[model samples]
Target chain A: MEKRTEPALSPLLLAMRGIVKTFGRSTAVDGIDLDVPERAFLTLLGPSGCGKTTVLRMIAGFETPDAGDMRLDNTPLADVPPERRPVNTVFQSYALFPHLTVNDNVAFSLKLRGGVVDIAARVRRALDAVHMADFGDRYPHQLSGGQQQRVAVARSIIAEPRLLLLDEPLSALDRKMRGHLQIELKALQRRLGIAFVYVTHDQEEAFALSDIVVVMNKGRIAQKADPQTIYSRPADSFVADFIGNSTLVEGRIRERHGDRATIATALGDVTAPAADGLAAGDAAMLVIRPELLSTRGEGVATFTGSVGNSVFQGERSMIEAEVAGVSLRFAAEAPLAAGTPVALWLDADRSFITRIAA
Target chain B: MTFRQRHLALPVAAAIVAGCLAPLAVLVAFSFYEVEDFELVPAFSFRAWGELAFSSTDWFLIGKAVLSGVATTVFTAILGYPVALALTRLAASGKGLAVIVLLTPLYTGEIVRIYAWRIVLGGEGLVNTLLQGVGLIDEPLKFLLFSPFTIALVLTYNNLPFMVLAIWVSAEMVDRRLIEAARDLGARPIDAFFRVIFPLTTPGLAAGSLTVFALSAGEMLTPSLLGGTSGSTAMALVDNLFGTAFDWPLASALALALLATLFLVASAMAGLLLRLKGARAVVGRV
Candidate 1:
């Protein structure tokens, strides 16, 4: 686990161009394009069966596309076999060989490549990087789920693969362990400086770990942007709703200005930060986050409604207010009881127009 | 005791075991006492044990039985593994039919199957006719029946289904995801099969081999039907001691000796299986 002295500024480590993969008659990964910047933590975020894992497998050479091309450093990946490719996968199951010790599992790729020089040393170094150096002598079953996952990560990263793909590597662990390891894995990726393409259905995990989040829906890229942009200004309704809990109220663009638009919804007219390509009269949804709405009336737009339900999360209380026959949810620090009448006010300057239907 | 209370069941089961071993215990007791006109005296003697131990005929017969058993078991395992693999890999719709087809020979009586093989290996059998039809031989082959080769073939055939069934069970228990994982980890098909599938199935292989060996060692009807005096096994020797010579003590001693030999073989194989289990643990670590 030699630390790269300087950031490796190589070109895009991998690319998927109009890739299509189908299982039975169902298209798992429809025509889509993806790019992994060198040394970047790119997470393919989607719900289950949305084909994020399929995309990672295609890049890893485990699954081939039926219609399009994949390139690793501008070279076609179609002809390369998995063993020959400079990519490795950390499977969702942590696919560690059940018959080999942790040291042996970590050393497997090195042994496969005929690296007989100080194999134990190499394994130790890799294990140490994941804080698992002492556990190398133990069997996989003897280790906890998180330990197995760390070993799986160590095993893959030991090869020093140019493109490391993780397919829901933490999905098997309990919530607390997954949370801890997500931070550690992000740190490890940064330290190793290898381009990572991670796939997960958990959007929170993806957003917390990735430098660039590619939000996918129904085998298509809803948006590919940095975590901040993906969270703050999701490109579409799917991206907004998938990335986080968002309230999409149907609306029509009433007016527009540079970087902002006024939308007239059934609830009322509200000013929303306009993304590029939005137009007047376009049917859209004002994507307001629950946290963005507040109890204090201090924004450009507001609505009055009766609170239907209120859930008190530790730091914030989420209140679902029935506005204009639609259940509009907003969050505030203060507790509000159900059936309580309140004004759902938004800091319209922060809200974005996420979706405008064709 | 109430009608619902069934403590009688345990006593009955214990009585059955004691009854079965009572004659064996008596035979063992008699083995240590000197014989006078087929009656055991109160005097303790080591003559029977010494004679049984030092007799070159006894040693040779034991050696022959062990060698034959080993050969037959090896033959069965070699032929059965492929069949087992094929059986376990069948589609769900076809698996039941395959099991039925393979178990048919097993359910058929052993003597009946031996008689069937006897006909097939006979001078005027279908095999000889087929060989003659091919013009590879001018006359029927006599060596096909009543030889050590025929004995081994019949024993292996008889034990084939058991070996195949054991291996099929192991194959069925193998985690399919491990194979896919190996492939995903960059192992080619052959490497995955040999490194993962083969080692994981070692327990079944050991079980199957031990079963085939023990059963072939004591096989009576198959050898008698297919092999005569030339390849007379230990069971036949034990039979002669009991029937022709009317030597019950010697027959019991021979039977005990055969049992001891099978026990030693089974222990050795069990040890091998344990080592394989340890290896499976190491595999898990990887």
Candidate 2:
């Protein structure tokens, strides 16, 4: 667990080009291209069965692609097995060997190599990285889920692999433990400086740790950008809806400026930020983030509707307002009673208009 | 313990003691009795035990029994492991049919199977005829039947299903993710097999070893019928002493000696296999 002295420069560590995999008649990963830079924490964010995990498995060499090529460290990964490749995966189940003690599990790869000088020292340092030094002698079943996950992470990183793939490693734990491990994982990634390819269905988890987030939908990457860009200006309507609980209204573009367009919808025309390929007549969807809608904010008046339902979360209350045969969800500081008529404000400058995904 | 389990334990315990331990106790007592006339008389004596201990022939036969058991156990383990692991990969219907097919040899009654083996392996048997007809050999092989080879081969074949079944059940319980994890942690397929698959299946291996060892070690019918010159066993000698020679004490002594020898061997095999860390992981340290 030697710490890297300098920050990782912009060198492409791995590249997957035109990777396609199909199970039976259904395509899992369809012609996807992904590039991971050195020391980059890239997360594939998608719902279940959206082929995000499939992409990670392909990179890990567990599932070979039906078509296309994968290269790691400038070497073709197609001919290399998982063991021979300088990559490892922390499985979703934390598939730790139950029979082996934590020390043995951490030292497994070193023993397999057969020429290590000091296995005990390496194992100790690896355990120390995950704060699991005292629990090396215990078996996997004796540890809790979170502790086992820490051991799994330690076991994967003991060999100092060039790239590490994690498949929902914290999904099995409680929220507090997951948050704790998320911070630890981000710090570990920064210190170790090894590129990580993580896959998770939780958007919040993906955004909390990833340097670059690749949002996927229906076996394709809908958007690959920084979390801020993905959240603010998604490539399509799918990416916006998938990343957050946003209200999408069907609209058609009326006119356009440099980065602004007027979308004619049922609630009337309003100016919003526009994505690429927007002409005067193209059909688009108005992306309204829930955070932008407020009851007491300085913004243009958007809609007047009756509140259908209101859920009071701890910080704010989420109110669903029905207007013009559409359900509009917006947040409020106080819980508005059902059937109460309310005026909602839309920060048109923050919202964007993107094409409707087929 | 739950009330149901506590109440059920007593009846099971009573049945095992009354059914099994009672017969063993009678044999132990009989081994210590001195033979009087043909009518009836019993007195404390160790003459039968002394003869059994001192006789070289008796020791040799006991050793042969142990060797036969160990050899068969080893053979069956090596052969059954692949079949059992393969069985785990099949679909449900295939597995059910395969299990039935595996147990087909046992269903054909021991005596009938022995006779059938005599026809298949005897001189001018099917194997010899086939080999000669194919011009592979000039004469029928002499050691095809009625030798130690025949005995070993038949004994291993007879007990193979049990080994396969035990190992198959154990291999089925192993999580598939562990193998992937092994590969992910820099292990080849062979390494995964040895590290994960083999270790996790030790409990099944122990169960199979005990069963095959016991069945092959004490086997009397197959060897007595198929093994010509090497057919003479301790069981046959004990039989002769009990019925033909009319010496109950010596028969009891020989029987008890054979039982003790097999018990010691089986216990050693179980202890060696089940003492593994993998076994302890599954069944807990015992």
Which tens-of-lDDT digit does each residue in B1-286 have in candidate 2? 8998899899989998899888888877877777666742566888889988899988888888889899999999999999999999999999999999999999999999898888899889999999999999999987979998899889989999999999999999999889988998889999998999999999999999999998888888888998899987887888888898887777888888899989998998899888898998877742
The fraction of reference interface contacts (C-alpha pairs within 8 A across chains A and B) present in each candidate is 0.40, 0.81
Tell me the tens digit of each residue's lDDT in model 1 across A32-88. Answer: 998788999999998898888888878777678999988777778898877778788
Lowest summed-lDDT stretch of 10 residues in model 2 chain B? B34-43
Q: Each prediction's DockQ?
A: 0.30, 0.67
| Native-structure RMSD, model 2 | 3.3
The CA lDDT of each predicted structure is 0.81, 0.90
User: lDDT at B277 for candidate 1?
Assistant: 45
Q: What clash pairs does model 2 have?
A: none
Best DockQ among the predictions, by candidate number: 2
- What residue runs in model 1 are displaced by over 4 Å at the alpha carbon? A1-10, A60-67, A73-81, A252-264, A271-283, A299-301, A356-358, B1-20, B30-51, B76-94, B119-147, B184-186, B228-230, B277-286
TM-score of each: 0.86, 0.94
Model 1: per-residue Cα lDDT over B1-286, one tens digit each: 6765667677888999999789778777766666678664755677767778887888787877788778887888779878987887798979989889888988888878878887899999878989999999989998898888788778888888888888788878777756656665667777777767777777787778888888887787777778866576678888897687766667767777777887897788767764774345533332
